[model samples]
Target: MALRDFALLVLVCMLWAGNNIVSKYVVAYLHAPPLFYAAVRFGIVALAVFPWLRSPPRPLWRLLVVSVCMGAGSFAFMFIALKTASPSSAAIVSQLMVPTTTLLSFLLLGERLSARRLFGICLTLVGALAVMWDPAGFDFSGGLAFVLVSVVMGSLGAVLMKQMEGVQPLQFQAWVGWASAAVLIPASLVLEPGGFETVFSIGWRFWAAVTFSAVVVSVFGHTAYYFLIQRYEANLISPLTLMTPLATIGLGVAITNDPFDARMAFGAAVALVGVLIIAMRPNQAMLFLFNLRNRAR
Candidate 1:
């Protein structure tokens, strides 16, 4: 990749990393109800992508299922986890998505994994769990469960997405944004009293955070990422995107005062390496050497 594009990828990583901290503030600090907050955020994305909502993407039912799973369901669980969990820990837990997707593929699609991938799966799961054993007040049992559920939802949604065709990134986001808003907005109204008032009373920081998440992260960030996905191998892109979790951990410590110790750091490192292993292409063992040769130029 050119230096300019590499820099762009890093910017996208930063935006995604910052969104975690920003969302924690919205739900935990501001006391915005998690479901309602997610509804509002998705609403913003829905409106932004409404143009693409005119014609339904093919395989409409599958798209709907994927939208609900990945959009409203996954995000609802994440925001709930964010309510009590440190963003750093929650971000670490979310790495389970890579393994979860692999497991799901094996079960649902009968995809066979290499021995290396099976080891990666076990390694990633154990390492992700290890982080929660923090002696600090960051209780993993509570928020960790929610994050795990979110991971499963996201992973399954991705598997379903592989069965899809002709669903561009914008079209997919439009479906997710609109479908999520449709479900979550109503659920929030019924379950969360004063949902509307909270929206009205929020400060500029609140809107800024929401805008950053909905626009910067969802819109520009994913679009640029998809652009790269088209240009490069997914394994190459996946390794680089690990920067998001690393950045999130730093921001969570710096901004949110998240507890971090040697054990947690080691566990995070192990888990990310596992993710890289799982995300590697079939020929990645050889390709890494090739990449090293290319990068030396």
Candidate 2:
């Protein structure tokens, strides 16, 4: 990656890290309804990017599926996890996305995985298990379980998205915003009664967080990321994006006062190393995303 691109990606990571802290605050501290928070966030994103919604991509069903998977499926579960999970732990667990994406490509896209990558996957799983270990009672963390589901959802969306063509970043965001809101709105109503009322009770603080997530994180940060990914190798980009989690860990400790003891630290290091190993090598799925624009032409 060029120095400039690296710097840009770093900024994107900072934005994402900050959003994670903001999300945890809203769901855990402010006691906002997780599903409702996600719904409103995406609803704001949909409105902000509505202009891009004009030119819908082809194979509309595929786009919609990708949107839901990446948007509502991942984020709703993540927010739910945040209701109990520390931002640091959630950030570490989300590294499972690297291994999960590779595995999904092997199963769904007939991609072959090398032995080294398989080891990386195994290591990542082990590290994730370690991070979620409740040493006190010898039980698993429920919050981390939801984070696992979120990772799988995001991984699936990324793999599916690699097969798509001619979808610009903002256009993709527009669809994701609309699709996620569509799913989350009704789901929130059914699952979290009076969610809107609770959110409304919070007033401007809720809107402020929603705006930051929608505009700063999704619109500016992610759109910038899409542009860079198109220009750079996925292997180069993937490892660098790990900065988001590291930054999240620091922010969580400082802001949220998360308990990141020795065990958690060791697990985070292991999980990140595994993710790094997976990211450093070329994979079919990453290649597909790198070549998406070329394939479209």
Candidate 3:
């Protein structure tokens, strides 16, 4: 890769990593309601990207469906999980999306999976369980369920995004934001009492979180990701994103003083390894190993 591209890749990683730390602050200190916050964040995105929203190259309905799955479904569940699960745990569970997306593609899209990929998927599942197996943690069952749901929804969205054609990343992101906001608005109103009033009552900290979420995380971070995608293949991009979760775990430990137990460390390592295995194309992995051996020699 060129120096410029490498720098851009690093910048993308930093943006994604910062999102995890920001999410923790939003959920804990800002006291923002997850669904409501999502609604607001996407609302901003929709307006910001309004000019780019044109007739999608693909079927409009398909784009809308994927938008909901990727945007509303994923974000709603993820925010809920973040609220209850520790940041480190949430980060680790998010990696489950890689395996879930692979399995879903194999099932729904008739994508072929090799034996190694299958084994990697199993290992990912086991690692996810290990991450959430704390006996004394707060509501482990509920948190695990929520995080798993988020992973599934996010994975489905990702697979769907692959099937989609003709939508620019920004245009797709605009649709996702608006569609998610549309669904989340009503849900927030019904499920979260005093939703508007609560938002109005919150201090600047909450609004700061909202701004960061809308502008920095959603818009900037995703844009950087799309840029990388344009430059590189998905397999190369996805595995490098394993860094985001690892960064989140580190930030959670340093910033929030969250405990860094043996279980979490082991589980994260195992899960990340599984994710790498699943994401790395066979040829790419082989080449990588070959290069490593050559360098050693």
Better of 1 and 3 by TM-score: 1
TM-scores for every candidate against the unseen true structure: 0.92, 0.91, 0.92
- Model 1 agreement with the true structure over 47-129: per-residue lDDT tens digits: 99889887776778999999999999899999999989889999998999999999899899889977888877887877787
- What's the lDDT for residue 147 in model 3? 79
Q: Number of the top candidate by TM-score?
A: 1
**Model 1: number of clashes?**
0
Per-residue lDDT tens digits for candidate 3, residues 5-65, read: 7777777777777776777678656667888988988899888888777776667777888
Model 2, runs deviating above 4 Å: 136-142, 282-297
Clash counts per candidate, in order, are 0, 0, 0
Q: What is the C-alpha lDDT of each candidate?
A: 0.88, 0.89, 0.80
Superposition error at 274 for model 2 (Å) = 0.8
The alpha-carbon root-mean-square deviation between model 3 and the true structure, to one decimal in Å, is 2.8
Candidate 3 residue spans exceeding 4 A from truth: 135-142, 286-297
**How many clashing residue pairs, candidate 3?**
0
Q: What is the C-alpha lDDT profile of model 2 across 121-170, one tens digit per residue?
A: 88788777788887475233558789989999999999999899899888
